[model samples]
Target: MFSEHRQRLVRQLPAGAAALLSANDIMPTNADGTMPYYPNVNVYYLTGLPEEDAMLALFPGHPDPALREILFIKRVDQLFVKWLGRRADKNTASEISGIRTVFYTDEYWAVMKRVLPLCSTIYLHTNEHARSENETQTREDRLLLACKQLYPLHRYERLYPILARQRNAKTPDEIALLRKACEITEKGFRRVLQTIRPGQTGMQVAAEMIHEYMQHNATWAYEPIVAFGADACILHLRANESVGKDGELVLIDAAARHQYYNADLTRSFPLNGRFTPRQRAYYNAVLRVHKQVAQSVKAGILIKDLWKISNNLLLEELVGLGLCTTADISKHGAQHYLNKHCYHNVSHFLGLDLHDTGYHDEPMPAGAVITNEPGIYNEEECIGVRIENDLLVTENGYEDLMKTIPKEAEEIEDLMNR
Candidate 1:
């Protein structure tokens, strides 16, 4: 799978160009202790190896076939292995990455000297996401800076745009991994439903979800949002300290990561295993919009259009609930009323990362996966409801990856009460 991904990337590159991707640095938290290392997703996408201080270089037009693909890894020693365990040996690295050419990190400069002369352009990878606010210099940053200093005349190109375009549409193997991730997430949600009680703290509920994920050899794709009642109104809420009241709704936007692929899911259910009248009204409204928006996921549809459709459906529901009027929508615009209850967009691309990379303005392609989450938060009523499911775009329509995960109000109540 990794070899096929690398081949696709190589085919996109120009004939005389070379590209470089590096593994993430082991960040330090305090003295002697380091934070858990996560390899750069792009590097992991091209090469299945998930270790720090590793790099991949691709030069499709290189004269020697052996020199076209190179995998550089950390050199192992007795002292380092004693502390950090054994790193991948050459044969192991070759087997994992499907690249026969493996070299030590210390020999990267020597290998680059031989490879750089044959290429006129060097593709440098960087975090180009609009939301990225990375201040610390990464391994890729250092390598790119050093490359410019060494070879000032070589043209440098940004590799992020090409990678973003390619990674938007997942392959069959990636879809299978994603399906496994969603299955693990379903287990976690079921556990939460079975364990949740009226007096349990949000943190306790989050622990239950994490326990289920860990038991399945998965980890949190992102920080779990286990918000109770009014806390759910605050998007990206991480402080899971509130206690669940009997009639209040608890919104959990948690996901599990399997083999580096991610599954994002959100479910809002009542603490007492039944929603209050107002809570059910808002929850059903959000579910209505969610189901409709999901049906619109297919090839050649812009994500922005889906947002527009969701907003329209949600506006009609808001009018029915007496929260907003059609006159207000006509005068102040639908966004004005929609913003009162719904703060975020309806969907986002999902894959290796929770908010995966993709062209939002462009039409979605087959094999692309996105989240359909339409939420309504009423601060005055202390009612927050959100329903999220992963949708895979197909030639005919979309596949609801989380369809089996209970989303309907009666379904959730039945499972929780049982």
Candidate 2:
């Protein structure tokens, strides 16, 4: 699978192009404190190795087959073994990545000096995701600057755009991992439903989810968002601090990560295992839009059009619920009238990252994994209803990967009460 990812990039490269991707830096926190290390996804996507300070360079048309593909890792010395506890040796790195030519970091400059003079263009990796703020410089970002200073003349291309096109579509291996992640997430949600009670704190419900994922040998794709009452009105409320009363709603937005692939899901439940009349009414309305929008997704549909379908359906439901009228929407723009309740977009590309890399304006392609999440929040009434499911786009339509995870109100009530 990793070989196929590398070959896909090679197929897009111009002749005499050398592409380089480096590992992420170990970020530091307070004095002598460092955050957990995560391998650079671009490097991991192609090489299947996650060690820090690793480097991968691909020169497709190089005369030397050995230099055609090379990987660099920190040398397994006594110091490294003593502190970091046995980083991958050259042999192990090659064994895992299937790259025959592996070198120590000390050899990188010598290797690159020899390879770059033979290539006409250099492809470099950087965070090109549209939503990325890029406030801090990255290891790859520094490499880009240094290459321009030293080589000075070779044409450089952005490798991220090429990679985005490749990574946006899931391969068979990637799909399998995502499917497993969704299944694990399903287990976590089920754990919550079985144990959560009306008197429990929101964090207590969150603890059930964490414990379940840990048992499955998985980690959070992101922190769980478990909010009760009007706290749900704050979209990013993650503390799960307050107590959930018998009549209030608790929204749990959480998922599990399996083998580097992630699934995203969100569900709201009543603490008493049965929604009040008003809560059920609003919940059913969101469910109506969620179901319809999910069915409308398929290959070749413009992403914007999907948003339009979700927005129109949600607004019409609100009007039907007598929250507002057609006249109100027309007088004050549709968004202005509905923004308080339905503020966020209904879908996003899901994969290695919760919001994975993809062109926002592009058509939904076959084999792409995406999310369908439609939500409504009423701050005054302290009600928030969001139903999310993961989907796989096919030639004809989409397959709900989370189909086994119950979403209908009756299904949830059944599980909780039983």
Candidate 3:
């Protein structure tokens, strides 16, 4: 799976370019402790190694075939192995990554010196996601500074854009991994359906979901959002403290990360296993919009139009729900109603990161996976409903990856009652 990914990247590099991708730094905590190291998605995509201090160098135009691609990983001594268990050896790395040449990270600079003089252009990796922060300097950042200082005259190129575009389109292998994650997510939701009830704390509900994910050798893709009633109005709920109450809804936005790939899913259900008349009204409205927008997914469709389609459908529902009138819409515009009760952001690409790297404004191509989450939140009325599902765009239209998960109001109620 990874060898093909590397060749996809190499094909786009300029004839005389050398590309470098570095692993993430092990961050420091408050008191002599270090945070766990997360693999750099760019490097992980290419090499599949998650060890700290790892790096990947590619020189497609290099004269020697053996020097064309190299992967460098940390070398551990016996003492380190005794304490921390086993690490990937050179042979293991090569087998996992399909790259024939592997070296210890300590030998990185010496090897670079041999190949740098022969390449005319250098490609460096950095976190260029729109949501990324600039607060801390990463290992990749340090690498960029040193490479520029050591080889001052080399023309530099950005590798993020190339990788971002490539990652937007998933391969069959990546799709299979994401599907596995979705399957795990379904297990979590199914467990929630059987156990959730009034008087349970939000954290307890999240526990049920996490239990299923961990049992399947998966972890939460992100922090679980288990908000009950009006607490669901918090878009990104930070604390799952609220207690479930009869006739109220519990909104759960959680998924699983299996083998580094992620699935994002959200569902809202009644605390007592059945929605009240008003709750069902609001929930069905969001479900209708989710279905309508999902039909719009295909090649050459602009992502912005998805928001438009969802908004337009939500607007009509708002009028029927008596939240607003056509006259009010004429006066306040759709934003007024949407801003008050719903989130206009309907979809986002999902993969390694929860919000994956495809450009939102452009026409999406086949193989793109996006989340369809249409939500309605009314804090004052103590009702919040959002239904989210992962989608895979295809040449014909789209495939609902989470279709088997119980989503309809009748289906949810039946599973809970049974």
Candidate 4:
């Protein structure tokens, strides 16, 4: 399955373009303080090597498989293992990744020196692609600068676009993992429905979900967003402290990660375990947008095009709710405030990363897994509703990975109220 990923990546690169991908920097906190290590997804996707401080270089034009791909990782040490838990030895890394040629970090410079001399155009990866918000300089950025100084005459090209285009689609094995993630997420949501009550705070609900994820041997795909009442209006709200009122709604945007595959899912329910009349109207509208947008995803489709269609669906729904008039829908009512309300687009690539790393402008291919999430927020009404599901594009239309989860109002209400 991953061989297909390699083949796709090879086809996109220039005939002689040798690509280099590096893991991200393990961020530092205060003195002697460090954040939990998270492996970079792109490097993991290509090599299936999960350790930090690793790099993969691919010289597809090379004549032999031994010289075609090279992987570098930190040398395993007994003291380091005791300090940082177990580390993958050379043999273990090679076995898991299917990369035949692997070397310790100490030998990386020597191997690169050899590869650089043979390859003309070198594709170096940097965090230069367009994204929502970014501030930290990546390890790849530092290497890119060093490589330029060392080999001034070597033709260096950006590899971000090539990889992003290739990663936009899903592979069969990748899709299977995503499905498992969605299944875990569904279990958590159902658990929440059973445990939620009017007086409980959103934090309590979040804890229940966490327990469920851990029960299924999964971690959070991203930070769980458990917002109640007006707090739900904050699109990226994390702390789930606010008390859930009896009549208001609770918006839970959460998912589970199995292995490294991620699932992005959002489910909104009433604090009283049944939707209010007004809440139902807005929630159903968001559901409609989600449904319509999902049906449009297919091979060779563009996310930007579907985004436009989704915006129109939101507009139409807003008009129906009398949040704005038909003239406002025609002009710039729902579309204008979509960012403030929905905050994010309906879709993004979902894989090893929750907001998986990849270029957005490229066309989505047949194997790619993406999220179709559409939402609406009304601060004044203290209502926020978002419905999200992971999708896999195929020769036909698309496969909804989260389809097994109850989404319709009646089904959700039955589950919650029962």
Per-model CA lDDT versus the true structure: 0.91, 0.89, 0.91, 0.81
Ranking by lDDT: 3, 1, 2, 4
**lDDT per residue as tens, model 4, 1-418:** 5556666777777876788888888899999998988987788888787788889888888877697878888886889888988878888888777778889887887888778777788888766546646776778888888888888888988887777666666667877888899899999999988998988877788899889999989999888898888888888899466787788888888889998888888888788877878888998899889988988988777877788888878877876887777776557756565665666678877787676655566667788888888888889888888888888888678989889988999898898878
lDDT of 2 by residue, 94-186 (tens): 888889999997789899987999999999988978788979999998999989998999899999889887898999999999999999999
Total residue pair clashes for candidate 1: 0
Give lDDT tens digits, candidate 1, residues 128-195.
88678999998889999999999999999999999998999999999999999999999999999999
The reply for model 2, stretches above 4 Å from the true place, is none
Q: After superposing candidate 3 on the true structure, give the runs of residues whose Cα lies further than 4 Å from its correct spot.
A: none
- Give candidate 3's whole-model lDDT: 0.91
Candidate 3 residues 1-418, lDDT tens each?
Answer: 8999999999999899999989898899989888877888888889888778789999999999999999999999999999887889999999999999999999999999989999999999888888777799889999999899999999999998899889999999999999999999999999999999999988898889899999999999988998888898988984366778898898899999999999999999898888889999999999998998998899789887898888889889989888999999999988989999886589999999899998877889899999999998889888998999999999889999999998899999999999
Segments of candidate 1 deviating more than 4 angstroms = none
TM-score for all models, in order of appearance: 0.98, 0.98, 0.98, 0.93
On TM-score, the stronger of 2 and 4 is: 2
TM-score of 1: 0.98
In model 2, state the lDDT of residue 415. Answer: 98
Off by over 4 Å in 4: 1-4, 63-65, 328-334, 337-343, 357-362
